[model samples]
Target: MSVDVPRRIVIFRHAKADWSQESDHERPLAERGRRDAPAAGRWLASAGIAPELTLCSSAVRTRETWKLAVHELPQRPRTVYEDRMYEASLGELIALVNETAEDVNELLLVGHNPGMHALADALAGDAEGDALARMNRAGFPTAAIAVLTFQGTWKSVEHGVGRLTAYWSPQE
Candidate 1:
């Protein structure tokens, strides 16, 4: 099979939601989350990590978080809303990534966790000791970004096949 290696896949969980809201999926980002989203975006921009495509969950919080982050991106990428990403499982998330258009070299997925956290752990290979330990200590926080590299095409991305390039959390 021809390998269509994706240089990087950045997964971001929506920022913290207002718990006082009734509907979990509809909850908007909390005040703290709003502030942190831009900070995280700045970090990505400063690092020269820009995505070619953005796949975001349809949930309000996730959408809002994506909006905040995209502002800091050096260039705006094409975006698509995927409802399945709202509460997807690790396997489902992988499938979504694999389904991305082949021409897109870098992809960003903005969704929720523990699916995001689980996917990170499942795909990461040879992660830095400090990063692995930190990921294990705390499930990915809202507004956290996990950068993973895959050797083969996005269509062939499988569990345990990616290297953790970097991880960024708001608290860090």
Candidate 2:
């Protein structure tokens, strides 16, 4: 299939969670995280990057992050929740992106890290700034977003083929 180049994908790691809680999966966003969400959303909007579809982990923090971020975007359909996204690996996340409908040009995936960071590093080709290195060093912070561009279908995206377009963090 001759897919178009420059397909955009945005990956966001869920905001900070309330560690006081017991289970990691059930932890909600911390107050700072709650505050950071809208800021991150605004940053995305300011950059004119909006997702046509949002795929988020069903975890509390992930859902909350999505709700906050989508608020900055134009009206659209509800997000797709994937249970597998809760603690999915980079490979799993890539597979999920590949499964997205071909009609959708832009997509956003919000989930947790190690996986998110790994995916970013995997898809990124010659990351220019300190962003990718910072991401690798500290892990994706709460309310951080990485934008990538692929030259073919998501299924066809491979290492070094996806370009790192941008990276946004709440702290900066």
Alpha-carbon RMSD to native, per candidate = 1.5, 1.7
Model 2: worst 10 consecutive residues (lDDT sum): 69-78
Error of 1 at 39 (Å): 0.7
Model 2 segments more than 4 A misplaced:
128-130
Give the count of colliding residue pairs in each prediction.
Answer: 1, 0
Clashing pairs in 1: 4-153
Model 1: per-residue Cα lDDT over 8-75, one tens digit each: 88888888888864687788888998998888889889868889899999988888888998899889
Show pairs that collide, candidate 2: none
Find the candidate with the highest lDDT and give its number: 1
Instruction: List candidate 1 stretches off by more than 4 Å.
Output: 1-6
- Angstrom error of the Cα, residue 108, model 1: value is 0.6
State the displacement of the C-alpha of residue 49, model 1, in Å, after optimal TM-score superposition.
1.3
lDDT of each: 0.84, 0.82
Candidate 2 per-residue lDDT, tens place, 43-93, comes to: 888878867788999888899887887787756545898899998987888
